[model samples]
Target chain A: MAKKPELDDFRVPFFDDKGKPAKFSPGEFDPGAKPFSSGTKEGDRERLAVIGALLDGLQERLHAQRVRRVLLVLQGMDTSGKDGTIRAVFREVDPLGLRIVPFKAPTPVEAAHDFLWRVHAQAPAAGELTIFNRSHYEDVLVPAVLGDIDADECARRYRHIREFEALLADSGTTLIKCMLHISKDEQKKRLQARIDDPTKHWKFDVADLDARKLWDKYQNAYQDALAATSTDYAPWYVIPADSKTHRNLMIAELLLRAFEGLKLEFPPAKDSLKGLKIE
Target chain B: MAKKPELDDFRVPFFDDKGKPAKFSPGEFDPGAKPFSSGTKEGDRERLAVIGALLDGLQERLHAQRVRRVLLVLQGMDTSGKDGTIRAVFREVDPLGLRIVPFKAPTPVEAAHDFLWRVHAQAPAAGELTIFNRSHYEDVLVPAVLGDIDADECARRYRHIREFEALLADSGTTLIKCMLHISKDEQKKRLQARIDDPTKHWKFDVADLDARKLWDKYQNAYQDALAATSTDYAPWYVIPADSKTHRNLMIAELLLRAFEGLKLEFPPAKDSLKGLKIE
Candidate 1:
């Protein structure tokens, strides 16, 4: 049996000044530094390929184990590379076991239900994997920033989310939450690029800048959210997202560590499914 | 550019033998003599591995393209390996870009809304991958078999589904629907195994056998569902799933072909991210 990788082994620091946790602001983080590249000095490309191969192996083993579920929740501001990160890290994974859910603005019907109702409906089953581009965090992030709910309601939700996640973990599901951190200047440049490039025009949303205006509010929400909710069972990894390549490499490494610890093994068949006389 | 694999190359004979274009009926077709060992033959194992590699590659490329989304829906009867198939085939995929939504008994909220409401909420974003363990097809299959709704209502859903799928395709989402076909005897034995094995008891549901009693009706529903909905834009693949190894191999091959044809490429990076200019 392979020993579990240390949790610290997968940790990628997003903020340079980590001595003070609460004081770490997104703007204080240098978006231009290639933190991931710094770590990848030892053959990053080869490590990526190896991670790809290991993921392929894990997919097959997970199939035989018949545990068909993993949920990966990614939360970040614009240019955090939610799309880019997913493409770079998971490019090598099988489409069958993998499912990606991107949550947008809630429809009128969604607004009618308890916020978690829509999210629960989409949770992955055992023996499968699910990804949430933006998830129930929106209940906290959006509502907190927009004052959609009172401070007390948001606080109550923080406890509710911790319980919700604990329930999932106790029920044989592994929850990996990630917060992609990018600086405001980098976000502005990325938003500008989307406008300047015709191919990317489809991705630009005028409303994104509206969200940017409330950057401090969003950051406070994230800090409070992570501090209140990050647990031993389901922890949060804050990946620096200024460099797309670095972001991809960091996310991939974290996943590789998680899968390695799953202790997945192939389920032995009653007999090899060979030569069954099927007349 | 690599040549795209033709759809016909991955077609299974069982699909045609059960009377193509006719309503599906359980036990209507025989498990013809084994053409080859159903177990992972040497060639099959290598092919499975290759398929795994291909999926990983496609996932990354698709993520890069950031314009296309893929939805894979797996539907089948009890003990038909919907869960098993997903785990085994997609185990190697990156969890970031993939999402899995398993449609179970509808909640009061879901039941209140149109069936597609919950589904559309979980649809993949551009450059993401989503899987539905059971999908909107249940509106047709479950209702038709249980007489939950009148035949006219079920018939109406068939048309609605075709239009729904067409819309998905037109919106840059590629739809791959699969029905896992398992024999009654095989199902009984598996159910027995679940009962006999303590670790497996959690998976058994007495209600599954209740559905088993009405097997033929479910089959008829599936046939109608497939015939009416399978289209040029979104096609359905009926996989031979009695043998787990064979089922995994077939599903993997089908996906490999779908992705190979996508011609996915990485998006260009912004000049700012291309290389850092250190001060």
Candidate 2:
């Protein structure tokens, strides 16, 4: 029998690591694949809840320690389930510790600065688990596909991103970036469902169709950006997002592992607080 | 059957409203009373869920219209369930629309300004449903209980609060203030439970007990403040909060009625995009 696939199997290979250069293509992995799934839907949901409980414990420890920080960057096409994933994965986690930063289109003031400027300002501080719903990657992906930035400029921006992320990593932030991979067919179904349900129409904007028209270019832009920036310091994972449950479960499992890797423990019972009765 | 209790029955009577002047006492309301309960605990939980669903829809309309704002201010002594109330009441509401702002002890910078300065900055914007876990009421209550402020000064502060709330209401904001009323015995039990559990110690400060000892002073401060500030625009409600389920249900029902009062509706559909298929 074949050994089951591991999470690293889905990781975008490390870029330019010493003597271990690697590569990735957005198309190389199947968005519909459930390699990380717990087989049945119910089983996957149960696994997600277990992971959620574990994440909650880890998050509380993270807050208590008030030292280490975390940044989870999620980038996906419209309807790839960034909001849904957040709502589900964090169902059990205390909202106080989980900060969700959804970066919409830049305002005039934000557009005035270097792309990294606004992104830098929102980076998680100590003892935070911050999720970037769409992030600095938007500065790279949106412009590269729109022909507002050439290949050379895009390469320069990627290098800047690598350095910015490295600064965060060196300063005690553990970064995990996931690209919510979804197929064109999946996008069509999701978009149409939103259109058919007027209540959901609020979540949709007609401009989303404009993005769908440039799907191929955006896909290539994502491929280039992920391949160029996936480093051991800030690894990128291609989360198969065609299935909502699969996407949520995989992300929760990845986060659980990342948190477990932190070896977080509550601050040693405060000696000053020991057996001190409240007056 | 006894006449069904209405939400207004719990409302602190309006202060200084022409010939209809009224009075209120925090002691007059029993914290153990389940005036809004559905009799059985299970029935109360089901009622809470139904109200929660109605709030979710109303919140969606509030967001879609992007015209009106709602602010729910929750205040109580330690262990009065402000955090728990938010969690349960908003369990079904979209997180995007619900913004929970927990105001802690004022910082040096915050303390530098007039009491309402920091609070005014956090007021709900158009199309928002904002919750103040503890609010400007803290300014009046804490100082009055500590005797740092004289009665005349406390009364002045209460007047300032009424004016500030009036500003919010006049600016298209709907205000709902709930004082989660719990008994001193319940407070002792809750505080002791936190002390017994080291994990929850982070949420409890030893100083909290210092305040607990002044419980009567704080209760008197609350009575004075509520009587001075409860207006038609921003009336206060004394919530019997010993039963967590009932407190949640009562708040949910109050908000549902408030939203129902607004008669929020989806913005008319866009005609230009009607029948325009995504290419």
Candidate 3:
């Protein structure tokens, strides 16, 4: 029998500090695999809800303590279920404690500054749980895949990204990054469905098809980027996302495990309120 | 028999633009009133859920259109349930479509600028629904109640608020402001509960009791601020909040009504995607 799959099995291998980076291939992962599913769609959803409730309580404790920060970075190809994962995974989490930042194509002002400028401004503060829908990773991925940046420039951006994320981690930010891995055939189906349904046209752009044509190029770019930046402080996980329910379940489980590892608890009771009575 | 309660029944009489401002008194409204309640806590929660689902759909259409903006401002005394309202009312809305900005005491940088300077930066952008939990109103209420700002400066801030809101309204933003009104006795019980429960002590502060002692003064300040700043463009409503259920219900209903009035719908299907087939 095949060995049971673990969350670690999907993590991009750690970058070698001794000048020999580990090899990673996005094509090696099967997007249609259900490694983390609970067997049935209904069972997967039930498990997801259980994890969601756990996450919700943990988030409240995080806010009460007000000493830690969390950043979840989500990067995926078009229609690979990035938005759906957030809406599903965080359905039970308090919106008050959650901040979602979606980064689209850079505005003129944004492009004028260093790539990390806008992302740095959106980093999670103490006691915050922030999710970046699309993030600074785009700065490296888009330009590299489009041939606008040479290998040296792409490598430099990766080094900067690692250094910037280290600064955040040193200041007490826990980061989790995921790449929603999907197959090229699945993309064709999703894009075709959007085209068939007029109501969804507003979400569909012809430009997305142009990107789809460069599917192999994007996959290669992601493989390189993930290999370079998957560090101990900020690791990247490849999620098989052909099954939406399985994708949500895997991500929720991953996040829940990360938060539990933090062992967060409410702050100690205040001495000033020990014997006080409201008048 | 008394007349049926309408959401408008709670709105502060509009501030007259021509010379004479309207007369309004916060003390006149009963903080314990449940005019919008469903007569039972269970029923009220059900109604809130119904409105929540409706608001969720309306919010998606608003995002799809990407042409309009919505801002909800929540203000109240320390324990008036600003956080609770946000958590309960938006439980069903997509976190992607919602942004919650909690304005605590201004930082040194923020305080150095004019009062509205920080607020102007956070106004909702197009295709967004933003909520301000304890908003710019604090700038007016706090200084006035402490006697730090004289009558002239207080009046000037109100005018500035009016003009700022007018600018937002003219630019296609829909604004809804609510003041969660809790009575003194109810606040006493809530504070005592927090004090008695050591686990919740983190959320309590000794300074809250000091503010409670000046309850009447805060009421007067709120009354004056609401009266002077309540214009047709951005009106303020008093939400009876002694019962948490009724408070959530009323605010949800008010927002649903406001959103429905916009008649927001998904943008028309894309012409470029009309008959294209994905290959």
Candidate 4:
């Protein structure tokens, strides 16, 4: 019999203490796979609602405790459903407790500093849950794909990223990074849909096709970036995201597990307030 | 026949272009009224959900057009339901398109600068919908209640605020500010409930009780501030909030009206992309 798929099966092999991927390649994951999805969309959505409510409660506990923090980083090519996953999975969560930060092309001021400079400024505070819609990974992927950065420079950045994330983990942050993987054919279809619908043009730019033309090179850059940065402190996962429902379900499950692993509970009752009454 | 309730009946009259509330006093509006409610909690929630979905779509158009901004400011005494109102009203809105800024007690750095320094930094950018859970108004209310600022200083600060908000309005931003109003007796019950619940202790601060002890003073501060600064550019509405359901419903109605008044529509189709095909 075929084995039941576990979420860990999709996690990129964590780099060893010496900083090397045990064994991994972005190409090994099938973007079209739905290993974690239930039989139908309706069933998956029902399941998601359950997890979302639990997440909502867990997130409140996180805020109430005010000790630990959570950081969820999502990276994907255009149309790979990063925005959709956030909208669906957090549908039941309190917007007050969740913060979503989207990293766009750096400004002139941002580019003047180290790439991590801007990202570090936006790190989650105590008792906060922050999502990086796109992140510093863009720094490595874009420049490397365009040959704007040399191989040595790319290696240095990977080291910088690993060190930066390690600092976050040591400071009581739990990080979950996901790469929403989609097939080349899926990209072609999604891009065409945006092109055919003129109302979507504001989201579309002629520059997007330039990136699509470099699809293979971009994939290679992602493979290297993921392999180099996946670590025990901040592990990266490849989410087969052709099916939007499956992608939201899988990401929500991963976050739920991370929160549960913290063994969170409400802080002990305040002794001063014991039997006190507001007059 | 009894007069049908109008949303404007709750509005703290807009300050003339010359800067003065036409005829307003926060006390004139009853805190326990349910003028916007459907007469039942379940009905209020259903109405909220309907408006939430509409808000979700309108928010998307706002982002797509990238031409306008929306700012919703929520203020109230402790236990007045600022947090609850946000959770309930924005429940169905796209989390990506919404930003919530909760202003706590100013930090040392913030205190050293003018009160609006931190607030100005957090103003909504174009195509964004931002909510200020507590806002610059806190600057006026807290200090005035504490007697830290006298009448002349208070008047000067209010003028500065009116001018600052006028700048935002002229910059293509729409502002709606609501004071969630609840009765002193209702507050006593809410605070007592928190004191009685051990698990809620983290949310309870002894300082909260101190503020409650000065409830009447704070009300006076809010009254003066609202009457001084309410303007055509940024209007203040007193929301009846003794009923949590009614508070959420009324705020949702006010926001929907502000958005509809903008007459937002999706940006026109791009002629350049006509007949375009992804190769």
The top-ranked prediction according to DockQ is 3
**For residues A140-246, what per-residue lDDT tens digits would candidate 1 score against the true structure?**
99888888888789868977887788788887788788888888788877776666664453454455567888888898888777766676667787777777776
Candidate 2 lDDT over B1-279, as tens digits, reads 889888999999888845433667889999999987778999999988888788988998998888899999999999999988988888777666677788988999999999999999999999999999899999999988888899789878877998899999999999999999999988877876777777766665666678889988889888888888889999899999998999999999889889999989887666555666655
What tens-digit string does per-residue lDDT give for candidate 2 at A1-279?
A: 988988888899888945433556889989999987768999999999899889989999998888899999999999999988988898878766777788989999999999999999989988899999899999999989989999889889988999999999999999999999999999988887777766666666787788899999889889899988999989999999999999999999889999999999876554445676554
With candidate 3 superimposed using the best TM-score fit, by how many Å does residue B279's alpha carbon deviate from the native? 1.1
TM per candidate comes to: 0.58, 0.94, 0.98, 0.98
| lDDT tens digits by residue: candidate 1, B120-222 | 8988888888888899998888878898888678767877887787888999998888888777778777776665554444444455566878877888888
Q: Candidate 2 - CAPRI tier?
A: acceptable
For model 4 chain B, give the 10-residue run with minimal summed lDDT.
Answer: B15-24
TM-score of model 3's chain A = 0.98
Q: Model 4 segments beyond 4 Å from truth? A: A17-20, B17-23
Query: Which of candidates 1 and 2 is the stronger one according to TM-score?
Result: 2
lDDT for each residue of candidate 3 in B1-279, tens digit (9 for 90 to 100): 989999999999999878756888888899999998767899999988999999999999999998889999999998889999999999999899998999999999999999999999999999899999988999999999999999999999999999999999999999999999999999988889889998898898798787899999999999999999998889999999998999999999989999999999888888899889887
lDDT of 4 at A150: 90
Q: After the best TM-score superposition of candidate 4, give how far the Cα of residue B120 lies from its true spot, in angstroms.
A: 0.2
Q: Give the TM-score of candidate 2.
A: 0.94
**lDDT of model 1 at residue A144?**
87
Rank list by DockQ = 3, 4, 2, 1
Ranking by TM-score: 3, 4, 2, 1
Residue B86 shift from truth in candidate 1, angstroms: 1.2
**Alpha carbon lDDT of each predicted model:** 0.72, 0.88, 0.93, 0.92
TM-score of chain A of each: 0.86, 0.97, 0.98, 0.98
